[model samples]
Target: MLIVSTIGVFIAQGVQWRNHLQRIESRGKLIVAVRESEGIFWANGQEFIGFEKDLIAELERELDMPIQVFAVRDLDDLYGALAAGAVDMALSGTSFGTHDVIASRPYAMTRIGLVHPKTRNIADNPDLESVRTGLLDPLGHQDATKLIDNPPQASAVYDAGRISAELFTLVEMQDLDQVLVDERDFQLQQSVFPDLQFSALDLPARPISVLFNPREDGTLLTQIDEALELFDGSGLLGQMTDRYFGDALEFDYVDNLTFEKHLTARLPTYLSKFKFYADLQGLDWRLLAAQAYQESHLRANARSPTGVRGLMMITLDTAKEMGITDRLDPDQSIKAGARYITTLKNRVPADIPEPDRTWFALASYNVGAGHVEDARKITEKLGDDPDRWIDVRKHLPKLALKDYYPWTRYGYARGAEPVVYVANIRRFYNRIKKEYPQLDEAAEPERLEQLPDIDVPVFPGL
Candidate 1:
């Protein structure tokens, strides 16, 4: 009788799981709970984006349904919702629970470490209480007691609502001394604070995965695992990783030092000019400044052998088109360059989405818009999506090859330069945005020639 009762219990649990999954399918939306942070989830214009957000989209596609994101304030809130089935799953930082409750596959990882301002030098494996210490989380994870000197006291942690990057800012301002950090969080923060130092603690990397309720049934879990397997194998995971964390992975001391020197010594002189012209064109001034730095190392007197001149390195013909009588005058040069980028962006198809759309425009700014269109033709011929930057960029380099360019209208261009040019500008722009958080991008501006959204330009000399 006892054995029969246990079997009946198993049947009841299976029925409950079926009902849960059916309700989700009938509703037509899978609700996901997330803790919104820099790399996890955040807003991009009116639409939202991040690694988790992208994964949710992938999951939506895999399951053939829509996914809704419900943001919880902190881990405790996140866990409570998951336990009560208020959310179908969670996509956030590492979640610790009993084996049956956790998803089997890890989608991401984060290393635990100690981070502090450069002003303080910490020795290896030093005691936590010895310094002005804080934590990434207020309510500690499951293994907190085993990982550190003393478990994180709720009072010792920073405000739970503030994201890790914001705490890093407090560290930079000398208001906070030390904090426990997740390397993934600091990887994004490093763009903003090149001077902060990091030392990894002797702890295993935490694997981030979606958490579901503990149950006898594995139907939902099985679907999640299958979707993750396909996403991982298809290389979409790597592409998403690159989009979020690639820029910061390759660290160069000299490049950072040069950026630091110019940011402090030269940027103040031309900051207002960059902002003014950028506002008039509805572009980010930090992005424009990054372009100028790329062109001429922030020198007003900068000139190239190709006869491009001034801060933006505007070509004579291009300068003339924008009414720039003096390319050497920094203000005139910035305005003219801003106008040209908008012009190139206007040539891009309106159906494409930004970041990709802006990247396409920057590519045009490097090589002419005609050559980019030629590359798009090549992309289409190769059975790839022409609208995507990833697909178009791969084909763009083909234009330089003798075999490929002969078939194209704008034959034989340095297709490789635009790829490198756009990458450098993005790196510089990320750093500059973090370095100067005080600079707010201006609101909607008067469009140029009724052109739509655009990016900052790149000089043709690239």
Candidate 2:
């Protein structure tokens, strides 16, 4: 009996020793499982990006440790990896489905809604009611031949096969009616293809957060929690949240009132110049104006403390590269800015979609194209969607860190600035779009005229 008791004590001591070692090792590094999507968190190649990026960074700082993010195919894959000890935890803001994974306190929330092609003429839910009644055919399987011919007038269709890539092709080809898709996807689509339009309906928000193994308890989990709380306290979490989801981030109009007043006065000066440049580039003048407003508040004299100068805030290096002698000259600045942006857009991989392409270009514009390229390669490595602005933007700042950038082809960069720049641009774009509803209509003719004329220069090859 004494021998058996001695053996039991030995087993207990071994377990205690293992636990102590785990706590010690946990202090040095934290492994977080993420996904391969764009917005919530995903791998872009070798880089992990999205809101989770900022979260992880903040957590690392809080715990005084390094974070190693692992990319999975999707949220399900992440959960499985966590269960199997393939990953320490997941930071994908994964939604709580009926599946039983251990989830921490809810970190963020967003309503999920349907998205569709902009050309679909879906102005609102009421428009959908008419389509349901029969203004258009309810799209269905191609082999099923029998579409709802003259069926109830409806605004949209919900069939699975009808709303995927095939449906988008059909819309491009003018084949079927509108497709019902996720609203976030719609926003992403609209950003990439500014020509696409969509509306939203109130739906239950999918509250999301990090998930962990139920049975696992180690130093890493506690450190992550501490980081989360620290970020939340410092307002960085809120900042990151707003950086991704406009609604999630809070802003004060009072602080913006003076800037708005100044913008109201300064915006008009760029209208004609914006139109001229937009026409030249085959872009919407309003979008250009929106971009300008976002960049420099339409101020010709605007300058960032970072040595970015002039009305359009063109960097001296960028100005010199573009062969502009006058950085403050509005016409030259606007022209050079437009050309540079257009060039950046053309440089992005063709497969990367809108908003993301545009966002990447904008990020490259803020940082350098090379840095943006590095971030993209990292994104691909991390398993996040490199083609997504929502995903890539999160990874952009990681370029600033040597450990992360060493793995990329483009080397290192100052990444955090792009995140702020892109988010600020998005907010200004949304604000301008809301204020000037007719701007989109006015900008259409200019975009259409320039489309065929614009020569998008290919990267590496060009």
Candidate 3:
């Protein structure tokens, strides 16, 4: 009788275990553990966005369930949550190893690389013995030690917590000769330190996967693996990867930090005026402020050697055309600059979309509308998408070439200036919007433009 009862209990437990997916479906939500990181999983203030977040969203859609994401502080915490059955799964750049949790097939692969300042001649096979490598604490001491067979005499080892912090240490403090970082991260950091150079290290590519509780039956794992395969087959995975990681390669760290600093130290004085004029001109106040910062660093008395003056850095003719008497006055200058940008935006083809249209206008604001049109023409002639900012930005530099400019209607132009100008404004505007989210709720301005697709421009005679 005791043996019969034991067998019956075992059968009941097996039947109950089979209801895991059904229970999740009935609950209408899946609890997930996620760590916040750029290109992985992070919250963008208003919404959760990142590569892992998108992947989870796909799973949610496939299962017809919503996800309730809980933030995990680190990888250890993510694994703990999965082991404890507190979360259905954890989405991160987790590698496969331990049998404690089942890992889905790798959704992405990334390799590590070494970055060094251009001031050093490490390009032609660097001397591992002399190079001082900086490694993030999360990278593990074993990996750091393995980076160089023979350790350097002087090395700075510290963990800044986040990738951006480590990058800031490398660029601003100049404490380390080299940094071991992920390839994607190195690409993004290159935008900040234009002089920095990178070389791929001889390390195996790391596989990124999602972790599920080992206690669950293989059914859940099977479903997730099948769904991931479907996503891959449909090319959705590729599209999502491109959308998040593709254009983030170029971010100017110094300029971004400077803009953030100015927002607090300088922008308060002109905040009301910027909003007032921006509202009148049907523009985002942050965008107008960003343009002003790009032009004059928000200096009311700023004057260029070429006679452009005031907060907006408007030329004498531009001021007159916009019907402004005193270009030095902050209010008048801002209002005039808004009007001019609106006019420039109007001249762009109507088919161009919102944010791209705004970028084209900013480019025109720097180099003039004629040169931008010439670049667009060249973009189309080259059989690229002329409406897209990414394609046009590539052709913009070709205008400086003798062969290319001679054919353009506008002749030769400092085509590179506008590209940098627009990029700077876009970064500034995004930072401002993030720092001051309340500004949007108080004033219903249009959504800010996306980051530009152009490389960081090296302006002439800066």
Candidate 4:
């Protein structure tokens, strides 16, 4: 009798689990956990570029369910939210060994190390002592480095915030002798702070894999694992990693000097045109120049093979749609471009955040608004963040897929082009914002530029 009851209980539990999953599927949306931070893999931003984004997008395509990203304060908070069932699953550059959440196969190998300011060094071998280190919070003491006590120095261990930021801050402020960090974080910091110095002293052990909550149905874990397999095998992950870290863009000192010299000379003359549009749009003129530079290096006669023409590469179709008949006129073109960009913000779903909204608009400008909308529809269907550029941008490429397009409200688009186009624009935007402080105008063009003549471009291509 006892054995029979136990078996009966198992059968009932299976039914309940199956029903729960079916209900979730019927709902057609999945809730996922993510961490909000800078250096990539962040949800809210102008540029959402990273390897993690690639994996999540693939999962959405596979499941054909929309994925919603929910962010918690930090790793500890994320796991706590997971345990509380506040999130269906979580993905970040997080490590395992936290709460015994079921884990998928390791996606990538991340090196853990102690990072310090370039100006400072281990005073002696003993200085390595008293240095506190950690991967994430709970892994806090696991592979942490401590003072040998031979020199007996005091150091405070903090598992606070993203390890990357903490490490960056530590080096930036020369706060600690060293802060534990991953090689990726160190490299990222190095790119931003060339003068700063830091070293990567390896942890005592191997890095751990990311984890998810174990479920009896195993479906969630299975989906995640399969997605990881696909990403790893497809080489997309490797490309993203390489794009961010492998061979970062190198500025040519000589060429840059020449360009700067030219910009200094010509910019003053052209500055009036930019200022004209900036004032009209109530934006900083520098931002208008930045946009022009990104679109065509401020070249008024720039033309692309695709038939995109004019200073801003405004297609003839766009000019007509924007009610501008003159394509070559700089002032009219710039104003039309600004208005068109503004229109994109209004067109994008209200839920999407700023910068990302801008990114989607730019993608639409390069591609078409219909394609962007189609990507968003697909994003909604696939259980991803439709409002998030990181999530929706991934779907942009799929519009070209015949099978994928039929299901979308807007059909058949060359999705891959937008990703590259937006990425390039993002790089250009980031460079200007970083290198030129005076030009920054809340990172918004409308608020910063002053408009004079509204020159709209006429492209031969649709």
Candidate 5:
């Protein structure tokens, strides 16, 4: 009688577990708890994008269900929601060994570090007595705090707020001498607070993972594990990591801030001309403005030592071919530049696809179409996708090498210039889109023309 009762209990548990899996599939949406932080799960105002968000997208595809993300105020809220059965899973660069929640296999590792204003002179190994160090609250970071051997004499461990927000506040207010943060979060904050600089602390790497409610059956966790394994095995995970983190790791924060300042102060005077010509050529006005800023910082009278002049920095020969009588006139210069970019875009192969197609056109605008084709051929020869800009840019610099250049149609060209040129324009365009979100819909050409031109100093190598 006792053995029969034990078997009956096991059978009932099995049926309940199966029901949970069926319920999830029948619902057709996975409820995920997310916290907004850089490199984790933040929105760009228009769309949500981040490393964890991308991972969730892959999981959703694998499960054949859409993910409904619920925003939590902080990490504590994220875990609480999971515990309360409000969300099926949670992700916020969570590390292993977190209590209560079952953590998935680590997808990435990050280092804990210190960030301070670039203007400040904090020592590489400061004595704890000399400066105040800010740390995120004592709740979920006991492990991280234990690693800080020499904590500051005056420490402020925040109790309520996002970790990134707390660090930013401490630095911006100059309330703390330094603050501890993950390297990935520090890089994300650099875009907003460009003056902040980061230094890695001597600490063990934190493994980033997804967390699920402890009470849930193993089915959901199993699916996530299988999806992650496939993503890693197929090299998609590495590609995604490179796509998001590569630029941020090496970005020039100061230069980016300076360009942003120019977008507000200098771009208004010529925004109309760029929009006018961009509309005529069926291009995004911000892209044209980005290109103009890259070439001449939007100065109509700008001239390069290479004999390229005006807003677009067109050569005298090219200007004549484009039917522009006055290269220095902002209107003529912008119109000719748009036409030139459009011509280059049309010249690229039709099957290249967007973004890549646009990138190829930008490269051709910097160098020539022939040189770009050479780089594409080199990309294909090296077993990379030629249609992808990321792959092709790697081969662009090889044009300078004797072994590679001699074999290409374009005998010799400064191939690396176009790579930098395209990257700068893309960065500038993104900044403009973020800073002036209304520019596309609300900016009036006449109003922009009415704004007085702000005299911006010409920077070298622009």
Candidate 6:
């Protein structure tokens, strides 16, 4: 009788587990459990952003179901949530070391980071030999360092405990040259030491995948694999990767250091105007400040070769239009610049989605809306998606080429300048955000502390 009862229970669980997709479909939305509100998944204002969010959206579209995601206080509770059927599945970069759950096909690979002092200006890729002259390779991964013609001698280790910031402090003072650290720690250290340059270690990486209870049906897993294949085969996965990573940009050591120094020195004097105007325009203050830095390095009396002036670098005509007599007045220039950029953003095609739309507007500020449109035409002519900033920026250089410019209505504008301009402003804005995170925004969403723990008695495995 006991044996019969046990077998009967197992049979029932298998039948019910097989209906995982049906359960989710009947519920109207898939309930997703996450460890925290960061990295893989995070909320920015009302809209959610991040690579995992993209994957979640893909999963929803493929399965034809909506998803309502919530986070667990502790990631360890992910197993509990899955076991209790509180959530359909959990998405994480790493599995929590148990055999009770099964992982979907791997979708992404992770890379560690390498950091070092900026001893000299690296125009493009630096000579590893010079940059790594005294860096202590922490993980002892020598394969990446083999790029140097002669291996960099291992330098003295300053025993300031184990944090990346401590070692980076030594690098800042030129006591050491470089060091390798975990990517998470490396990113955390950048805000304090923007002066340091960073690059990814060319090393083997483990693949990351979503996890579900093994008791669940094979059909859901198979569907996930199919969904991933769509992204992989379409090459959209690669494009998305480039969009999400800070490592995608070229490292400019000197420029980052200067931005860092100016943050302490000059930003304070006019910060009130920056914030006040940014708030009025409904823009991120860091973004406005970053644009100003790119224009004039926050100098009140800054003058461009083309006759633009002030911290915001407003042209004479723009200053007059904004009802300001002096283009060099820091207060007037800053306010007008914010309004102008906001106007440019509004002028962009309503169909274009943000952050991309705003980036287009920034490009418009540099060249003009007409030239940006011409670049989009060039991007489309070359068989690329003109709607994406990544695709559009690739063809921006053609606007200056003799072979391409004569054909454009705008004629010969400095096309390469806006490309570099947008890229630099992105880097600067990120640095400022890192240094000064979420300062005045008050309406940020509150993460759930403890989700209601459900109890499912008959479920087997984890």
Q: What lDDT score goes with residue 254 in model 6?
A: 69
Off by over 4 Å in 4: 1-27, 43-50, 95-99, 123-136, 144-156, 203-210, 214-217, 246-462
What are the candidates' C-alpha RMSDs? 10.7, 18.4, 11.2, 14.7, 11.1, 7.2
Residue 134 in model 2: shift from native, Å? 24
Over all chains combined, what TM-score does candidate 6 have? 0.74
For candidate 1, write residues 1-462 as lDDT tens digits: 999999899998884433555666766667777777766776544455678878888899899988767765466666655665656677656434233355648777777676786767544425434445556664434344235445343124546667777778777776666667678778776766777877777777777777776541456678898888888776567667766776676555578789889989999999999999999999889888998888888999998898999999999999889998999999999999899888888889999877778889889888989999999999999988788776788889998999899999989999999887777777888788656654234222121222211211111111
Worst 10 residues of 4 by lDDT: 453-462
For 162-269, candidate 2 gives per-residue lDDT tens digits of 223334445555444554433443443243333344444344555566776655553445655666676666556665655566522423344345446755787776
Q: How well does candidate 2 match the true structure in TM-score terms? A: 0.44
RMSD of 5: 11.1
TM-scores, each model vs. reference:
0.73, 0.44, 0.59, 0.52, 0.79, 0.74
User: How many pairs collide in each candidate, listed in order?
Assistant: 0, 41, 0, 40, 0, 0
Q: Can you write out model 5's per-residue Cα lDDT over 251-326, one digit (the tens) per residue? A: 7766887787888788999877787889999998888998999999878999888889999999887798889988
Query: What local lDDT does model 4 show for residue 59?
Result: 77
lDDT of each: 0.73, 0.58, 0.70, 0.59, 0.73, 0.69
Name the runs in model 3 displaced over 4 angstroms: 1-32, 37-45, 48-68, 83-89, 93-269, 279-284, 303-307, 315-323, 342-357, 368-383, 401-413, 429-462
lDDT, residue 407, candidate 3 = 91
Error of 6 at 437 (Å): 2.9
Candidate 4 to native Cα RMSD, angstroms: 14.7
Candidate 5 residue pairs that clash: none
Off by over 4 Å in 6: 1-17, 43-49, 72-86, 94-101, 113-203, 232-240, 246-248, 439-449, 455-462
Candidate 4 residue-wise lDDT at 245: 49
